[model samples]
Target: MAVEKLFESENFLIVNKPFDMYINSDDENEKNTVTYHVASPDSHLSSSLFPLHFVQRLDYATSGVLCIAKNKSSAARAGKLFEKRLTMKYYLAVVRGHVAFEVADIEFNVGVDPTTADSSHRMSALTTSEASERCLQSRHAHTRALRLETGYYDNRPVSVLLLKPVTGRRHQLRVHCSAVGHTILGDYTYSGTRDSMPHRMFLHATRLVLPLPEEPLDIQTAEPFFSDPKFSSKWRSDTAYYKYRNKEDFKGVCDILNKSYVIGVQYKMYKM
Candidate 1:
């Protein structure tokens, strides 16, 4: 599978990463990865000009905008932006159940589940009391949810959520959404089963904003698979799936949040 380039510059490259592709692979023989395509001398990009480095990671099943730095200095700058919580990461997800809150901030502590014997370690959400008792090295995770649209598919209620994660913890969005009783559709790990889920996970990294040295880099990607008629047919005709068709709608969301942030700049700026 070819990686789609969304935007590129002297300092960095942004690509629309497809589902099931790794940002980087552990094995040199593994050729199906974003790094391989961008860094390979034989590939379309000039490998020497931009020694690509992944700036952010997405789950194997998740799809959306991924940033790659051209050099060590650019990578370090981007890392500092993320560390300072100045980077804005937006995700779109179709989840089960009608989400009650129009907007909410979910705060949960995450820790590795010791009982899982599989190589793919599963992270568990710890209750406040459990967090204190276990004394496990836990990280606080935060996810902001905005209800973009609502509809039903196959007689089951589902909603599309615009999620902004403040903390970059593993499976933070998945766990927080589930903690609020709305698990992302097709998330077998958190939602229990993928029996009725779509072929791909519903989560997509739709937009990313980073404060670069030159200017703020606002990169966006169209909904990878959700906008396709094949997926739309499953939803009701009057759902948000139809309303959120263009980039303008996404921009409107950002604008509204920006206006809100202006009032509480300190705390709201870092959140959605």
Candidate 2:
């Protein structure tokens, strides 16, 4: 799979990560990971910056903007930004059920099961008592949602959500959305077979805001799965729910999102 470069500089690189590929895999034989592709000899990057480092991670099934550092020093600098929670990560997800509020925050205690391993190790929301018992290890996760639109998919209620994760835990948005009875579409682990699922996970990491020493880097990726005709066709044919009839309308949507969330930052949009 070809990785699409969004932005590139001497110190930093941002790419549109494809769905179903790991940002970095533990196994050396897994050649399809982002790290592998970026380090390939045929890649545009210089061999001097061989081991490009990922500042953050997106799940294998999720697609969107990913930040890569050109060198170790740059990676360390970017890591500090993430540690201080100075980076604002935004996601766009298609979920089952109509989310009523325009803006809302979901807070929960998320922990991974110690018994499971590999992809089977699923994260779960712990009850208050459970969280208290394991306070030392468990993490407090918070996700904020801005409802973009509420529409119907195959006569079933579906909503487009713009999610900002205040705290980045594993699967924080997915677990929070599911806890609220509107699991993300195609998230079989959380949503179960409650409603019809999309062909792939409906969550996309739409944007990232990183505050560097010089300036803030705001990067965004064009909606890959969100605007797919296969998914949109499922919406009610009579309504304009999921329709982007032309390029102008699509650009309008992008402008609205940029204006609403990413203010006063040098922003760039990348293709996938």
Worst 10 residues of 1 by lDDT: 263-272
- The digit string of per-residue lDDT tens for model 2 on 1-272 reads 88888899999999989877877755657777787777753232343336677779888888899998888888888999999898888787888887666556577777774544345446766545645443234577877666667778778888887777878888778877876778888887776555444677888887788889774698877766546898877865322333333434544444444354354433322111
lDDT of 1 by residue, 1-272 (tens): 88889988888889988877877765668787877876763232334454566778888888899988877888889999999999999888888888766666677786665555354446666655745443245687877777778888666888888888889988888877776788888788876665345776789999999977685799888866556666777777335523454687886775544333233222321121
- Number of backbone collisions per candidate, in order? 0, 0
- Cα RMSD to native, each candidate? 4.7, 7.3
Best lDDT among the predictions, by candidate number: 1
What is the TM-score of each predicted model, taking all chains together?
0.84, 0.78
Clashing pairs in 2: none
lDDT of candidates 1 onward, in order:
0.74, 0.71
Candidate with the greatest TM-score versus the true structure: 1
